[model samples]
Target: MSAPAGGRRAAAVDPTTTVSRVKAADPRGHWFLLAVGMVLLACALVLNGYVTNVAGETQAPAPATDVSTPELDDVRSGGPVLNLTAGAASSAGPAARTVALTFDDGPDPTWTPQILDVLRRYGAKATFFAVGSKVAQYPDLARRIVAEGHEIGNHTYAHADLTAVSGWRLRLELSLTQKALAGATGLHTTLVRPPYSSTPAAVTLPQWQSLRAVAAEGYLIALTDLDTKDWSQATAARMAKSALPAKGRGAIVMMHDSGGDRSRTVKALDLALRELGRRGYRAVTVTGALGMPSAHQQAGGVERFTGWALNLAQRASGSLTAALSWVLLAAGVLTLARLGLFAALAWMHARRTRRGRRRRGIARWEAPPPVTVIVPAFNEEAGIQATVMSLVQTTYTGELEVIVVDDGSTDATADLAAALGLPNVRVIRQPNGGKPAALNTGIAHARHELLVMVDGDTVFEPATIGHLVRQLADPAVGAVSGNTKVGNRRGMVGRWQHIEYVIGFNLDRRAFELLDCMATVPGAIGAFRRSALVALGGVSVDTLAEDTDLTMALCRSGWRVVYEEKALAWTEAPTSLGQLWKQRYRWCYGTLQAMWKHRRALIERGPFGRRCLGYLALFQVVLPLLAPVVDLMALYNTAVGDPLPVVAVWAGFVVVQALTGWYALRLDGERASALWVLPLQQFVYRQLMYLVVIQSVATAVLGVRLRWHTVRREGTFGGTLPPQAAPQGALAERHPDAAAQP
Candidate 1:
């Protein structure tokens, strides 16, 4: 019944093959998305207080330098305020028995407001050196400082130590602070305070030079004469006592309003102001004490515009961080939930399958049904011979026919397969049509009502067909999916595929069968009833994943599709990354198409819609899309934020996967030692698969049509049974774990 090799070709055309040209996926789309994501993450880091250091300094204080000079002597011996603007050196202080109270690191949402309330109650005016990053975060607080007769001064953009930074850094710090103030309250301050500075006597030679640089920029350095030491969390009485000027001398007292818990500072300020009022000492702003003009001035339009832009950028970054946080949380919860559910369902399925096997022990099929095996191949010469040989060697005690349909291969696939010359094996040569059309041709020519479909690169065990067809004994089952294993697991790529097949595919199948939510009967090995095929009008060529499409169609038609773990087949896996990407890209894209085509099933009353479709939508499409973003966040955290949490999370995820992988291998009768590769899969192989999903989604959304992608096979197990396959004349039950497989 075999047709001659290279028979006359037919002109039948496949609509899916009508695209103008075969194009690989555009690589720029995903790369561009990755770039945008990285940019957003960088902005997030800046606004979240990582780059700006707004969370406050924890480093040790700068040591005092022993070096001295004429300029250092003048600054160290001067009053609390120094003015060296325009090369002029001068010093000033408040009148005797008067105090100029100044607060640093402020405009705090908590203590600043309380400190301001105390000032208002006692009729005292003070100066607050506001951090620029804080002003941008709480503009209203900065404005309130000015509205209540309080003065604002620059504390650098992020409280950076001016003496430790370069000259350009000094300018940037002052400029950024001015801009922040301008944007928040439309005013800039001339008064400046270098962070970590105290009494004028502590001004070292290096500190004096930094002060000179600030003076050249036309800023008056406001140094503290009396230090309250409030930043160290000292007691209120001790701090209040420190603010008292010696011998009724004029002084500038320093305190803090932010940068940790400020409760003591708030009470200390209240106590100090009360004592100052009792002593008949008036508290005034730095400018009022020095008898100089107001330090605040209106900002120009350009400064205001630049400040506004910074504000917008910070706001956007904050919003993005917040959104990603929630998304990460949701993804974590959903992932854990899915893992738990799958494990539980798989266990139940295994239990039920074991029970069934025990009840049917020693029983055999009363009358074995005839079977037809169809192998639709195109340019699969590398493994076609082994595929046909495996089918012809099947030990089924029923009528069997093997059909190898060559869909216009430009290779010697037809010749090699027909050369076998097995009596029951046939070769049908036709013009190139896609896999679905070739499958339909095989179905039309099949003589048996029971049919099995296998790929040209797959080799099956002698008992595979018998185990596969036995599931059809149940009248309600329309199809059965066999277990497909990676045949070449000697390389890293092969090892990764092996783990994925055992964990992601086979484990999922076990659960899907229990829930009646089977989404796919992989093309490698699947069995179907001929009547069911006719009712569904044969396999549809609308999607690239004809196997998935047909399986979903059957589920929607109220037919049960079960998984048969005992029916094992070994298929060649792509050895290289490029070929793997192409194969998965087509799979993911075609699955998307099938899901879209069967969308109406969502509202239809059946498990197919409520369970299977919902599962695919959430776990397959939505979760995979979000995985990249989550992984990027993990990377960002590891690099910038705390890496402990990231490491802990990664370790936990791997532990869960390792446990699951071990269980999957045990159920499939594989060595548990293979789980060693599971961890490595997370770094490179997992990201590659995720990228495939991303590219496929982009292609689908853009309405781009793709030509069939053919993979190059190496004939890893050419024309031979896998080592683990049943021995020469042994029965399937003789396998050690045959009864345990489910």
Candidate 2:
């Protein structure tokens, strides 16, 4: 039964030398991508394909065949077009009459396999230009595409129309896809298909040239001659009508096998291929379709290509140098931004600590103080019932009243309130002056000495109110804030936002807690002392964001705002991009308005005042809206194959940030999944923060005003979880009566 020596040896293969395999979105995948990107970043962005098309003289039109064909207007009596172009033909072959059967938007789990099976049966090879995100989702399929003797082309990170995104963005998009694909396969890509087959037109002359210059370094275009229209039509008949050719002109048919359902496309491909076979014509690869020169010519062309290897290498070296320089510049800028934010945060923290520390002291001496809950409700009828009902069900011991203020709701926002019929919950109606005005009105009428503000559409844990109130018991604290999270987790959008909240609000709050100035107690679940709130003239609706205003005012008044991580509330995140944008726009506008409204606080140096000096340097002065622009610049430098050293600098900083974020989550005893996800939070998610900051600055500079109420899809919240449909590991289930007896 014992294995032979050879078999034993095979079983005992060396583990140390094995290359680790990674799945898509794997931590290793992310790190691997970061590393390869950094290295390729040094190698230059020329590996991505960009086609040069000459439309005019004096301008280097996209070097789309600088040797313009006779048909092109830009080409003149340049006696020999090929000689006029003055570049060697691609080592790929003499592409005189070849058309590659390229598949765009594919490697789908369903149809890709079928296509692969067909290609396998035919023993044919073709290039597959895949989207980065899709490839990221299905790396194995991408690997298989390459393994089966198919060339992999860069389609884009997202299938964005690159032609429209001319200039730096276009180049950057190509670079991102190329880098990601190369990182995936460890082989640089030299082919690309812009989304929608978009090409740089005459309007973007420099962009075209830049794209061409980058492409010339390595990649080549497999331009299309025929349209498949698979994604558009999708029906088998329509797909056949659009795809099957009339046996005349050899074609490069465009097809999609991914991005939603492509079953019909798959069925159509079978019919089309069979019909083509039935005819005298053949269905062959692009290389075969274009009669390529023999093996010797291919070898000779490769040999000829080696002649310019040194030149390409030099160009790569130059590009890497440029990239390193850009990275350095970016790091410097980001450092300035980080430093400025730090100073601002520190100043803000100092003021909060001055007030909060005393409260901490008070908590040590006495039982927790009572809390005033400020519920700033705009037009939130969709989910207010569940939110209020949940509040009534909380098991808190503190004397807390939910103050619901109507902020010019055009819907049945006010009607929903009276329907709830709770003794402790008080309803206040104010003119639709916006959130701040409503909060100010509620603050004025609040009966409790302590004020706690919750969004009318947010639900709380049974103990969240008590936990938040206890934090404020500390006499040193002017206010206490709890965690706000997405309660509605029905879609990919909600889950993504959930992760964002965990990474941003959860981790950032902990850091802020450590610093002692927990900035704005979100309007969603903020508890403030009545006097401290009134002292700031209630929440000032003059500013778009009253929460930010209140925090700054508390800082100015030497009041400490403490972050109570244990206090948790669940709220809805906007399910759509448009809604999210509107919410952020209002937030940005409000932040700017509040900053200007309380500009005096920047100069003041009280426990609250002096802290603002740091605030100014760290937040408002150096970094405020610059992060995104800096990122855009970094991406641009990368796209142009420039030397940028800032990538490393930011890499280190983000690593530290991610580690800190993980630590904060650990301290809070949150889900461990956040640890793995925090790093990605920076790559894709932090960019959102950059947008928020920019919008804030732009709104301030432009003096833009935003209305509070945003349109919403009616009846979009709190559908009862169907039988056996409850979420896995959901929060403790409450009886129907737990909220309010329906």
Candidate 3:
């Protein structure tokens, strides 16, 4: 959209775009649709009033005040519709005393009025689901039913079986009945009951969903347990005896008011209520009967129903406030975190600007100090050589060294490094203590003042190393973190991980940068001052997120961590979901550990932790647990009669991700190929993180630490990232020209 590499810079949107530009460029054309809808709504209201007030013989008479007008939002069922799936909701305890009676498939001329008369005599309230055509024909009867203090729901214009309608037609049946009934009855519906019952065939598709045919409006379908089958003709006495409940406290009595005659249904209604009253049984409306609030209205709402148009407007205000709040919180945190990060970065940048490294001109500082690149390798015979080669080929000239620590490798890691034969490249071997231990070994032996940590498995741009080091030149910066690009991004897991790294890590860091409080300068490709490293006692293997721990330590010690967007490292992503899960679980659990380890910053003056306020705290810590729960809620809400605001909630987060993701891609100079993964990231990567966070929390709460090792297969991405939320693959740094050469 930005006019590619070299064309006229089209009117493109950037990360810093304001709400106005966003609205203008938004592909959904929400505003345009909103305006059209408002006009249509006005027209509809006028027509509805016209149809309701003055439809002589042609239109059905208005329903009686006592007739039940159950809101039939998704009522296009040729067969039974199950609004609520079995076991969709979790229940804590049993109800003490309750009873619910619901009527279905009627508003017939013969039975409806008679049933209402009987109900009035007994002073009992019941729910009536009337058909559209029936109501249209017997307007007076509908009015009489309403007048008797009863609830009404739509049962479609006719009993059009939902099975007959697949897509739009399914939606059409529901929507038409809604508009017609609402107009005819002057009742804005809230409840729906499919002619049949649960996940209707119409709601399974995207197009039918958008048509919002049935479930679009805030409506809950009635979950009926008992069907009286009063539609079948029977002798009045026989029906009365058959329809009356013999046992059980809750029942949805299905009786028809419309269709043929309802003498039997009328008799059944009189006997049922008298029997209920006489037997010390109470007959009440559904809500009263269930003794539960059907709709969960936000505590302090001026209006109960919020349509998509209103939802967007409300979020526009709410998210702006949220974004501003996070910014302020992050900024305040950066202030406390500056002492350690600022001075070194200021001094380094001051040096770079004076030397004129790149032809680039900015308030850059003097060139950076001699930088030592530390590659912690363990049996990495296949890519260690290439990793070091990438470092040796870098253009940064101030001063740099390649320190490869072959941490007790049985393979040829040291041999591979020695073969590259670069003069300044040094190979150090130490007993394997894991990646953090190897990194510490490299840090201890390096002669230079600045240490650049990289992994053996990742490939990097020659300039990426330089760029990372250059960020350290700024005296205000204590450390610089590079971006991790997915190397196997061609596969499914790779593609998903590619999206995670790009969208999650990159976008998050950018926001962190904006706040000047980057918590982690990942070991994947990061540079730090020797004093800073030494001050923190070097990297520790005690935690899974050694890099995260180190970064937090640096910040806690007053170092400003800078995310070097220009520093790009191509690393292998988790090829399998299992490995990905383990990796992510470790990352999440480790972050929690680090956060706990650095809890002082959140309150007292320590780890850059104190910067987070209420919401951010939830987002960082509580949210991991909440995220999976939210997902579960979404699943339950959709599966049950209650659907959560999935589209609204997710699209909001995606909007923010898109803004920062595009920016990170450009900063990292990754091929636009990486951008393709952005969309799928939500469905795949974000969900995966939530699951990982959930597992992490569960693992942590159980007082169990992650195992030191797990099985990791080097393969292409496949099926859904397995549900395992653990670390997936090893990261490797490739030589700058390794992939480019081909």
Candidate 4:
């Protein structure tokens, strides 16, 4: 942690400061987390595609030309089973009065169990071709299929039509399904049935090629003589009739217990089995009816292990997707609710301010009080002259003095301010302490009860100090936040920050003032009662954000901090993406530190906890944390589902933001034309902001103390000051004794 003001060492980890060793970053920590997040996102997308049947074909078109080769003609003239093992083509059929019963696309949790019960009751043996994805999902059902004296076959993972996929996909489909069955049932099957394929006569040229490939891999292709067409939800009688054979010739009948509602399939199976039994036909497994060896072989160790891993991955992906879906819903609702609250409260605050102004004239001091403006400088020579000169040119009708504390600047910051030779401006030199320390040094030397704090890089308007200090006339108001504007908004980055300050910060402040829970009196320009500062122990050096920490302290102490929109100060915004990231990272991390320090206020009886802290937690912390997922979900929807709804939602949100930005700009007397950049902010700028938040939260959680780095100032306000007025009051013409004040 950076050394505190008085050479005091902070503890290794302190809740009050949230600072640990500065070099404690685990190099692989958040990066590893990011990698894991990406992998999980990939898994979610893949599972979404599988469940939604993306890029999958249930069936292929019949061969346009029934062109037949010698091999094809022989297969058509043969029976249901085709074998191309040992580089030889062969075919077979069941014995007389013997039938093979087979189910495809099964092990379904809902229908597979029902079908299994019927088969068991009828004493019928059958073969089940279970899809790999389903087998992983319903592993117990796969096991039940094998344990119930039934045979199992490979149906290919996800039930993709082999003829429609690549060679790698076809192999993957077969291997994954084998692994799945092996893991679930400790058995692998050589019986393979290509999805959407019926009798040999129905096999297309493309399917024959695919079957040859599977046959080369030692799989016996099992085509059906009779396709029950149960998947079409056919009537039970029609499907039962389709299951019957001609002239009691043995045959293979195909049905399904999954892929859709299968009540009719179940009914047809029962009806067919009873009728077959009465007709002196026996129902048996394919291997049984064909008098062949068992198709299921005990699974090898490697296949079982891989299958286990596949099942684990699928389960984890499914669970994560489910959890993310709920979180997305919650984040969406909270975001909309927050927008509604902001709009309503901002309108109410504006209306109340106007009504109060009409009822009683603008609140002002009968005799304006003397005020001291403190500008803390550290290597800020770039804008120090303009900062001090702007203060000297202020049109306040009271005793005014500008104090610039040079906090161990290696540059000529002190020299630049002293070069101004302003009678009322005092330049104080202090050892290199942090911003809070410098502010404290200036406070110790301040000579007036009313004090204004400004950053060294900001310049004030002629009436800024006058408008800012007037809020102190109400004894209950402890501080007033001035409107801070972007001085360098010609670039896209600057314009984005400009929009944020207007729509996000200022709008929130207006509502915060009404709720009595103002969070931060920004350091760019804010006025404070010196008595409140002294009472709260001046500026705290514990957290990085002294402004936020002190303002929150004041709010908890029952002192009101209000926003004064008329008090304007223009400060240079970061010019590039890298600079913006650094600046926002510091702000967000420091805010996290301050919030952590003031967490006890939540349980205290005050609006500080109920309103301020609650708002920050929900909108600032929780919402940003969920933002990436929301974006990912939007992209997923656009890729796999109808994208019109996503686009509509996005457009609606932008419209709402545009309206809010326009109102904010109008309230601050800024051009509505600047609102043109609001929509573009959503694409790049908004993601950067949320990433900064995520990084800050990660740093805080990891207990890594980020060293405070100075942002390189462009001095956009360097030459923009109006002419300094001659020393007005007798008290201002004479240089003040820096050490003479209490």
Candidate 5:
């Protein structure tokens, strides 16, 4: 097959090429996209508050209504009721027989419709103060109010108290309400009602100052002469009595049609309007009763667009907020579930280890069988000598043969191994092939029944081979995963990997062992029976994760794969973030391929297929895919909501993780000082891992096959051998015969 447009062919590309010089298979465009998305989300969050405040301020009950008798006479002389520019108030009408009824906080689904019905029955026209948000929500009701010959007035969007808000907030409240009304019914109003305080005399000095500011915005303040007090009154009769004008004078009676159950208000309106008509008073709209031109007018083009924009924003914010909430909830549940499962399974494994030790009485020592240790090398010249020397000095009682397979290295990997000149070590060179092919070639040339596979960069302990081979004593066991540690863990990134190895990898391995669902045996160090290897057709190169594929194949064929915790091997991990990303991307993508290859196993009956496949699907595939969303939700919460709760939750999780890491380190006999970097790791390293998983999944879904990512080898483990292994200088001293050849 031809190489992908932006990728190199695995077979043709030189394995010695440094990762930094190679163009990454997929560029980091997704990171850019995610950053842009976060920016948009932040903007939306800020706008959400802005719009909400505007809605609240406009929707609050305006404390005053126009009630000046002289203004009513001016309005009767063909002036606008509540003069828009002069900031003058108008009363019900010039004559005592005319009355205007105004309702506030309305366009309610239930009460507003019933109130409209009562008005229609009585042939009355009144002004309804409509909240902007309610109009946005129920546009049809606002239209119905206008269509029935009744006037609609602005009540602000959210009914917020304007007296307590800033000047900008007050303007936003009124303007947004106007836009909402225009959008809903294509009508605008000039009348303004400042929420809370009643008469101009009743308003405080600061409130009066605020009122003047609002007047500067072309709003004519409206105040009520009579308040029905239906919002506070429990009975309809008392509310009606309170709304009646004194001495049959012109009055603007205030009532409400929303914000609460308005049944009493509706009943009071019914009785009060009837009584007013009987008392020779005519009920009409504010403009009609006052003999002034109607303030209601169709919205202009700009106002319509503004209204549409606000409505769209409200809808978008609601949807995104809900989605973020659900994602956060799922992330929390999954995180807790994983932590609980790991802790419980780790405890079980520890108990099992104690019991097994007690039953066996000091492990019942036995000489292990002869083993062939295969070290696959491709452009791994930097660490090949150390790796071979480590295996050559192994203290296993049984015979050991070390075969170094050089898969066409451009460097001196083969020549270096040949120069090693250890008695049991041999170097075999072949044309370039991948790691799987190299391993298969080495397996084909093995001279023993028990086989150990170690990476070209790994340095094993003196008793690592013996510890690994002992696990095969169980006839059902086909492969054993050895404990792999990060040898170059002095840097922050390296230290984070070390913690991950112990807590994330090893702890989970223990749990998988207990569940009999152990997944991958690391390529750095693992052992397998020769017959089992042959039966599985050696290491298959169908997936990027040949180790995982082979292990799963063994499990499917009813062979047990176990973990050997004492078979310690120190391997070099990628030190840079870029290298690490490339390495993990390959691993994740390869694991996905292998999982897909074994998809049928999910339905198969047995612990290997059922439990193991289910575990892989949930933890490896599913959870990693969900992790990015979890992180994004964390960011969203920190951006828009109270960050203290988010911080507390995150800190709590980190603390639990630290505790788990401490326990895992104790189990592995490692130091606890590394736990301090765990929290910091969450910000950068963990996010990188999540992104790798996301990119890998995206690549797989797009059907783009990624080539092998070669990591730079620094040979950091050359002198870091454990005390039980040959001394650091022994490779040079004991191999003086071969050491002189170079």
Candidate 6:
């Protein structure tokens, strides 16, 4: 493809085509997963609040007058019990010798199945007043209850007490239970049992009023005549004794089938049925004995839809809960593993430093050989002069030549360098190519065996080049990486970057060098052997991180890459979040590209393939992908879980990181005060970096090609470079017309 306007090429591959294919293949799976996770998190928070509230509150005592029983005469006479209100009913009062057995608070998968089996064994029919939420959870059991000639009634949505709740809540409880029942079994019931109310005579005035209001909504309020109190009993015999009917009168006997271990209830049920049969009384459903109306009614259109929605919600909630649990578990394991690795690596680096110092004793100094420095610039007029002047003023006694390659800069970068008129400094102009292309041009024109590459915005110390070249004396060493520091640390963003350079980059480089798996000799300040650079085809253009790509290439070709700590290069860091985000995004995306391009090394026989590749996969790819999840879990724990433990764990990790940072600073001879910002950096800056990595991964997955992101420089390191004077007979003074052109 031809270069676009302003000498920048549009990506060779069409990003839209790749993005569309990715979307077409699995359009909504990721979106659905994200939605499910968010919903589950919200549900967890709400549940935590509810449980906390319930645990803290005290239960209200039942009134003494509410314990009275129905009159025996009224029970035998039956037929709606005239003393009851309009919406309420005491019993059916059958003339035949029959009794109704009703079980409440269930549809529990474990206990409900046992109860169903017992009822089926004997020819008995019972009514189950099930909590709506339980029915939604175990809809199969609800269906089995209806299929086996049993009646199902509404017992409120959450087993809420109508007497204590507001009228709106009472109605909502009834409606939700009805909807759940309809959704679960495609059927609805008219029987509504208000929780905590037994016989009609025992109902309080508020409950009576609620029941009358419920009757207006076309539901019959059911109050039992017999209270087995099976919930509090510990044995079958005691529960059976409580459930026995009084004087052979037809009555409704209340029992429980769920809400805890129900083995005793199940055992008592078997005994109760046998004893009732021996007395010539058969157990029947409440409506069957009462001769009112069949409670099993098919749901209407609206109710059926409501049932379907409730069923879907229950299944989704359950699946989401399980998935969230696994994600949180994985996040915890990964977080701990990362912390341990950092500590181990730091320890190893310290030991290696101590051992090297003791073994080498006092190091000897030597004069370095001739070297050529390459500075590639594109619209970097602001800092080009300082960069070139830093090279001219280096303290090394050996011969050094500086080549400034201007890659189609529309500014005065080329003119500014040429205006200095230093005989050792030369300005080379090229078409608007990218950084890698410019570096290649400079490498081709270089006059020395050793080459040093530096960014246009960077300034080096006087002894930096001399120390950097000493590592090349060992024939096995192909390149050396210099220590890079942020020259502008006045702003919060700059300070954070400064700490990261020391702790994250420099510390990691030390460990990587010891293991012979150094990944990247950073573009800001790295020295390369000419023969090694040529063997790798000189700076690849296939990736955004050409430095990393070339470094890996040299390592694969049997060359050692080392870090030179004494050689320091101060570079201007992006001050704004937006600029920083763009820079890091490009760096991350480019590194991924380079790693993928060299993926074959994973199976190769040497250390480059095994150790370096393995490290990249574990730390660079996997950890970055999982970092966001760890942050989310931390936030969740702080909000809903115990904040102290979360805070303690977070603080502990920060302390470990701070200690590591302090050690890195000591090694680099930096100020320890920079460590204070390390704690606050976790809140915003660290999150931003991981998010950038996430975006890069997402972009890579979508196969989108990103154009080069250019950072506008403000000459942050201008003060560090010595002033340069214009030569008396330079190009600007001798040929004014030639220098006037843009």
Q: What TM-score goes with each of the models? A: 0.89, 0.49, 0.50, 0.91, 0.81, 0.80
Clashing pairs in 4: none
**Candidate 6 lDDT, 560-593, residue by residue in tens:** 8988777778789999999998899889888999
Candidate 5 residue-wise lDDT, 260-339, digit = tens: 88988889889987887788888888777667788787789999888878767765876776686786677677777887
* lDDT (Cα, tens digit) per residue for candidate 4, span 243-347: 988898999999998888999999999999999999999999999999998899998898898889887777777788788889877877777776678878888
Error in Å for residue 120 of model 4: 1.8
Model 6, clash count?
1
The predictions' CA RMSDs to the true structure, in order, are 5.7, 25.2, 21.1, 6.3, 7.7, 9.1
For TM-score, candidate 1 versus 6, the one ahead is: 1
Q: Which structure among the candidates has the greatest lDDT?
A: 1
The residue ranges of model 3 lying beyond 4 angstroms of the native Cα positions read 1-368, 612-617, 636-660, 663-679, 710-742
Model 5 misses residue 416 by how many Å?
A: 2.5
- Error (Å) of candidate 2 at residue 566 is 1.0
Residue runs of model 5 more than 4 Å from their true location after superposition: 1-29, 49-128, 138-150, 158-172, 205-220, 226-244, 253-285, 292-295, 300-306, 360-367, 607-641, 719-742
- Candidate 2's C-alpha runs over 4 A off are 1-371, 489-492, 607-657, 674-688, 709-729, 733-742
Q: What is the Cα-based lDDT of residue 44 in candidate 2?
A: 39
Please give, for residues 203-317, the per-residue lDDT of candidate 2 as tens digits: 1333334434445544555446556777675578777666555545455666777766777877777666666555544555544555532111112343334423422443354
Query: Which pairs clash in the backbone of model 1?
Result: 386-719
RMSD of 6: 9.1
**Using alpha carbons, what is the TM-score of model 3?**
0.50
Candidate lDDT scores, in order, read 0.83, 0.57, 0.57, 0.82, 0.76, 0.75
Q: List ranges where model 1 is wrong by over 4 Å.
A: 1-30, 46-58, 65-68, 86-89, 246-248, 360-365, 641-645, 719-742
Which number leads on TM-score?
4
What is the lDDT for 85 in model 5?
56
- lDDT (tens digit, per residue) of candidate 1 on 356-376: 787864234578888999998
